[model samples]
Target: MKLKMYFLLLALGALTLAFQSCDDDDNDGISVPAELQNALAEKHGNAQRIEWETKGTYYVADFYEDNYEKEAWFTKDGVWQMTETDIPGLAALPAVVKSAFESGRYASWHVDDIDKLERKDVETVYVIEVEQGKQEMDLYYSESGIFIKEVADTDGGHNSEGYLPSDLSAAVRTFINENYPDARIVEMDVEKEMTEVDIIHENKAKELLFTPDGTWVSTSWDVRTSDLPGAVTAAVQARYPDYVIDDADYVETKENDYYWVEAERGEEEVHVKVTAEGVIL
Candidate 1:
């Protein structure tokens, strides 16, 4: 009986060690690089409950900051790439961004989720996921409330290697070169009804739309509230004295150009569309 009890105790010790080893390898059976760990610590000082994994060519860290879930991506050399954080609700969004969504084309769609994306050397973007019937889409908006682009939610995200410039039609390329001489195409997306292209011009990001046949639809970019046209600003102030212009978008279409301004007062929000000549639309 004494011999049997000793053997049982030895087995229990081994079992405990096995369990401990598994607890240490909980990060998907992959070892995180020391450099990445240090980089994460430096960037997100308060990050907690971190789990590291290899995502394609980058190291991804899933963790929590200030009780909110976040994911940070880093290059193999430990350079920070991007970070995405879960926004609790629409109320947590910036006033300008929220107002834009409430008045935009997809306003009636059911919002399923929202995230804030921060990338190095780029403007911050808000991503709102909305669904209607069997269709789902992810809309990207700049911090200043300018609509960026929308992509169908397939596989839950967008492809990093979007359409290449070489994939563009000749007419589309000609239009861009003729109109935006200094612009450089950065990304492109082709849909059923229209093709969308993202470009950088004069150090600012802009989105251009074209019909399937390569006819120019519109071009839009963020505009500072203070930089709005005098007539447009005056009209907004005259119409809504209690509201302050927070952000605006200058949209140039084939037929006309207008400013989409977001105005706010306390918790009240409104979107005003005005032509350059101050005609309210």
Candidate 2:
């Protein structure tokens, strides 16, 4: 969706930590069960990768390759907690993810992102959304690694248009705009069949799915100051429940930024501060 906001002509950046491993660090012991390890390796060994992280007292499983990545979370006691490439909450991960990663179906594919999807009530599902060029392939999976669904251009991928699958995150879009403002976005199309568009300029930057009618969508504008991502949005809303938006503006070439929201309740007046991340009460 195109995010509309006041443009102020300033720059803002939000930093989130990501795991880095230039060389596979197989030196660590398995935090996951031996059975689980064997199962994943046996199936996903082709482009299959395994990484671990700690979220609170639990452990998280991260799978990745050249163009995609997926996350599966678990407790130290071998109980599955939840999974998502974005949205930092412990919720049910779709069975399709576990199955696909467990089946080695994407073992040879290097994915740039593992898009996390969700419903109004259910926990988010993991989808291997690979951006090939002008085309995108949304590869769905089951928790046990079964291929559930694959959607792409119906014209046998002959069109130059591309789609954005449901799994995209605010971070992905914000990052692109903040880092690659010069990238040309030719269109913005989101409808019932799919959310696809054409981007003509990226200086050889790989398209999410370069194929015609690429099934990948592009979020092509700056985000509103009030429409930040999950954690930042939550933090601000919780921290500044009383503040009212006096004025909101985004400096051009960036998402939300340097905006003022004034709050006055029963004679107490104060200005709530919001950084690129969230409200700083």
Candidate 3:
């Protein structure tokens, strides 16, 4: 399996917010659920260009806060799940959190990106990305200063002199150039199912898996609720007006499109299945 590791660059005093996607009107034609709008207004008062979608069972709001980019996740009924804020330095983290983070295996790795992920009942945690040579890892720490787990690990061997192939798709090449400009392909393997390439970025290493047509296929990236289609989000909101969606997963097959949604109201949580036509099955 090819692992993908995405880390934010630590640019000091950079007041501009450079989002992953530049399209501000992406959510214009899509209908925003009233519950979602109210939730955004309540939690993210200053958030701009609030774009939303159903991700898993959460309604995710992707927006800009101050000079930094932020993403907030809420249940369909408007209960908040978590919010992530881009930050700089370990100084912003709690003393215990920083201590636990520094004690991890990748402690000496170069700091690539840092963010604060806050949830209601759970302790606040820091999502940190670090790089060492061509090796990169993402670490998570609790507010009480305990290492939670390593979210992603992209370290691999860098001797690709005999592995890398000359023929690579434009999309694959562009993805690497834009995301990992400082990285290089060190190893390549062609399997019966898909093609995989080992890469090293600033000493950190990771392998990439691509389909026959060069479509990236890997779980290295976490798909947020905001990444779902608008129709799915709208359908979820309409059908479960009384329940708050906690997470949602879209399932596809040759015959049907189905959504598995987890919802909550007060202390009761229920899982519901909905079809593409907005009918709860």
Candidate 4:
């Protein structure tokens, strides 16, 4: 009986050890859904050392591809949202993208960080984080070197006063001075996908848009509905008779000049672009 009891105690000890070993093999009690695993495999066949975690409504996968760390986010339903890859250095960026940043408006800012964002159905974007003094900003660029947009760092609470005259590039300054010599620049915003300058010329407010390289895109100014061109007024009256002409603007682009008119009837509103000759565009 004594020998039997001893063997029973040893068996119990072995069973407890086995249970502990199995628990250790489980990934912190987190089971990756089979759907998510399948999605990750389909998207990143070369991914290695993958680790998974749940963040908010997204399932995040951290892995390495080509020996570089990468992160991919997927929706709960296994739809790939985006992937971010760390760029080792500026040298790793495409030539056009690198050149654009070197010659762009924020060239003097110190580069803080860089990342490449690849979305499911959108063009890849390169993000460059830069800083000057207390002002930090994120500049986004396309693969072909087109400046996409600028976003100020929210943590710094930087209230942009708009670009000052000194901040304007020579080309931009020359264009404004030659075109609107007597105009005073009221404000300048470098956000969106282009630089916009607000000016007051001859007691009228006008906004000018420019590419990052200082090429002119368009100029626009508000116009009273009654002040709209006869052709524009007639066009709107004929097409949207029940809608009241509430607002209008005269816009001049390199290609052509047109009037943008807004018509509203209750909650239903329509915006129409009509040329000076009354043709709707």
Candidate 5:
């Protein structure tokens, strides 16, 4: 009995020491090199809440600036490697990359996150995370937006499940900025067939859809009352002086474009449809 108890104690001590060694190895004990820290300070002004960790041969610094999440990587000798800026939606991607991603392989996969990576070599790549159901992947694209290849996903599960290349993302954003300046996009969801961007104005959500090539697909939000063509708003006011314009939307179908307006008076609501020229239909 005494011999068995001694062996058990010896085994436990060995296991504890092994665990401690493993923990230390995982920590790496890497500190930010002075050169890397100075380079980062010069490049990004002041990094807010930055966290540093070693990955492979690179040291990654994750930080935030102006309410945006960004990552910077540096070498052990303090060489600035690359900076990655997380784009909120595909609409913000560069135009060339956007076009290539839409028509390239894995376009069907839903895009989740887009990181615009800039390296000291003056090379640029777009790291795009895409997923469908259970399967997830990361794809790399060239500076002009050509397909590269798949990379192992390092972002665990932070980016939401969706897919879109940056260029196409930018086009979508441009359309919204040009047409609906007041609405701000909040969430972007990509599907196999279409991409949807949700925007908000005055606490109301509006959904906009686009094709993979950045073609405007459809919208679920009423057009801003102020953005309505003067002719349309004028006609509505002339026809129903007491009613207030509550909703407006410019809709396009294969057949023709339609201007839709909804007006309200007390408890009464009215729907008016017209052509772009303000001709009531």
Candidate 6:
């Protein structure tokens, strides 16, 4: 009996020592560091407390608001902190990124998905992943926050342009300034059949048909004398050769097509319309 008791007591002591060693190791090695804690606090100022969880290979830090619900996450190494922003579709963007989408009038825009791509010409250009309704797209930007391009969108689920959050568009003017300088957009009627853009000195008007997903389906152009079927082209060139064509577009009619031209002169602009036939109408 004495020998059995001695053996049991020895085993208990060994178990206790092992548990103590494990506790010490956890406290010393796994405890949050002071510097990293400070950084996490700075990144999530609104966080009142953090609860940690082991999700496979990662540790998820659930930022709790008043200890009620989990809000955001920070990696074990203190990366990918969430901030507040009101971008329309993607709730994951930080407030700064949300501000970018709102400023671009993209809130009302619909998207299916977004993709970030790997293409570049200069440091100024950046890729942004955008999904508006049913269409997914990659929107590019410059270092100065200017819009660069709507690179491409495919039937595949990949529509994102692979730029980081630091790269996003904020306004239509920014998009136009970076991409198209001589082009002036006169109308964008959602109910209308097309979106019209005017190339003033070039005597060209382009109308792009857009899908509900904001995809450009077709692009139709009106040039002064392109041997096209439109009648307005013939009439305007014959009347004003030296005046310089500023803007021109055609409206379809039951009989034929009509072309209208406008030119910017000092302060006023000259407006002319030509009928489908070779008439000075």
Cα lDDT computed for each candidate against the true fold = 0.83, 0.44, 0.64, 0.79, 0.71, 0.46
The best candidate by TM-score is 1
Instruction: Let me know the TM-score candidate 1 reaches against the reference structure.
Output: 0.57
lDDT (10s digit) by residue, model 1, range 1-281? 99999999999999999999998778444677789889999999999888888877778888999988988888899988778888988999999999989988799999998988777645577889998998899887777786776778877654432221226789988998899997666556676778988877775779899998999999998887878889999999999999999989999987789999999999999999999999999
Off by over 4 Å in 4: 1-29, 156-281
Give the distance in Å from residue 119's predicted Cα in candidate 1 to where it truly belongs. Answer: 1.2
lDDT of 6: 0.46
Give the least accurate 10-residue stretch of model 3, judged by summed lDDT: 157-166
Q: Taking the tens digit of each residue's C-alpha lDDT, what string does model 6 give over 128-193?
A: 455665666655433334343344556554412112122122343344445456654422334464
Poorest 10 consecutive residues by lDDT, candidate 2: 9-18
Provide the lDDT at 187 for model 1: 55
Q: Candidate 1: give its CA RMSD in angstroms.
A: 9.7
Cα displacement (Å) at residue 226, model 3: 46
Ranked by lDDT, the better of candidates 2 and 5 is: 5
**Residue-level lDDT tens digits of model 4 in 59-162:** 88888898778888888889887778888878889999899899977988898778887765345667888999988998867667766556788676422111
Clashes of 6: 18
Backbone clashes, each candidate: 0, 55, 19, 0, 15, 18
Poorest stretch of ten by lDDT in candidate 4: 157-166
RMSD of 3: 25.3
What does candidate 3's lDDT look like per residue over 236-280, in tens digits? 777667887776665533456567777788998887667756676
> Candidate 5, which segments miss by more than 4 Å at Cα?
1-33, 54-58, 150-281
Alpha-carbon deviation at 237 in model 1, angstroms: 33
